[model samples]
Target: MRKILLLPFIFLPVILFAQGQHTLMDTLRAQLEIVFKADQQYRLPLEGMAKKYGWNSHQVDSLYEGMSIRDSIDLGIVTHILDTYGWIGTDSIGPSGSTTLWVVIQHADPDVQKKYLPMMRTAVAQGRAHANELAYLEDRVALEEGRKQTYGTQFQLNKKTNKYIIAPIEDEPNVDRRRAAIGLEPLEDYARDAGIAYKLPASPPAKPAQGPDKNP
Candidate 1:
């Protein structure tokens, strides 16, 4: 009977730990999805973002493949145009050293091509914009990760006090730090604002005094 009763105690903690970890992972992934949406809006490539996150190319490709139907269509249009018409060749350069090939090749019936050219140009411009936006997103992701690590360390230290049940830290700094830095607050208050319980570390212990120096 005692063994069966004790078994519940052991399993209970294991279950709770697993549940907490799952919640934290889900929250992190939700934040990542927001970042991914911003990238999609700007037509950012996922290759570099994947590499920055240490994900394999196959994983990155899978993510892009799984995008929503609307996002997939936009990406498809941009990629196809770049593949078909984006080339620049030395042979097409004019005597003045400017390449007229793109303009000439794109010329169809004056009314039709003129209407489409601006849309094509916008696609090209968005593609270039994507490169810059992806770079910014990569930096933002890295910064968020570093913030989580810092907050985790602080949380662990604060755990010594029973007053606080430290919650999983977020990746973003303004959110994580501002919440964690709130001085001497209860766990529920932090959880309400920051999506997690948090507490600052208790003050450090006083250093022991050095013994009087022995005469050399």
Candidate 2:
């Protein structure tokens, strides 16, 4: 993608140089900032609510319904930008702006995540996107596809324990090696942040029921 591409929003005038000096990049960046905040606005509150009231509470469910609406709107915006811009990255937009694109997609429905996975892989290959972010996406896509995660980045909240547990991972023992290649901390270290006391078993877990490539 070009460093600066004209973005003509359907709701607004053709983006161009103006008296206010609002260029296409400026509008795109502004949209990204709005998306970033909206993406978190419901989520941050939900996290606090989950901690205080528990996941199954009516309060948590109500907040989640609202968050789901915001997520759908954000997904539409992000997909539009991606379709128009093709994964433009930190060079064209700042880091936070670029991240907003990935963040929205990461939180999107599984089909959306799967559709954009290859594009993000290309972005990472071109150094437009972060490898670590790609790693997270890869793990999510794998899990969504009923395959074991590669980098062990995905976790599930165990309702019984009210604690998080790392999702099923392929090649459990060497997950850290894959993680290190992409600059993520070891799986155990990452699990700790979720309050999980996890360790790689001495023996590798049974090879994931044969499936598509899980290697990152």
Candidate 3:
């Protein structure tokens, strides 16, 4: 599945935007942004060239972008930063940087995500990270297995239409309430941005508590 940088303000903004004094998460977010953007910017070009020619096709032009070993190396650095410096609060890194962590972790190995999610989730509770960040992570972990996602962060690319389709999520009946609690806008907004059609329930069910995932 092709994953676009679906978390709003999550990709290019990290490069153009500035944060408060370089706290641990702020610095880590910047590094992670660089690597993740590289992956996004180049992965497609690399794949196109690979398909047209072949793997390790040295004849390929430099303009074709592809993921490199450097990505893994940098992910290790960010992981170390998270593990060592501990969770930085939303007060410190703000929403953009916190979302940057979500993007970074999204690209990391599943094992790495599993290891750091609890810490990241705690940061969300402490107001270090956005609750939306934890939600995005939960959705990603579930989407990896084709299970129902909790926060509706996952999207799938339609090859025939060349469009992005919002993936399945759990508790569709109460998705918006869950979304609002975590600082996310309505599901329709997200789906709209990706050019997907979304129809809300005629009326939402009872609201869930305004909390992050129960056990992300």
RMSD of each: 28.2, 10.3, 16.2
Arranged by lDDT, best first = 2, 3, 1
Error of 1 at 81 (Å): 36
Candidate of highest lDDT: 2
lDDT of each: 0.40, 0.86, 0.71
Clashes of each: 0, 0, 3
Q: Give TM-scores for every candidate, taking all chains together and pairing residue i with residue i.
A: 0.21, 0.79, 0.62
- The order by descending TM-score is 2, 3, 1
Which clashing pairs does model 1 show? Answer: none
lDDT of 2: 0.86
Off by over 4 Å in 1: 44-216
The TM-score obtained by model 2 is 0.79
* Candidate with more favorable, higher TM-score: 2 or 3: 2
lDDT of 2 at 104: 94
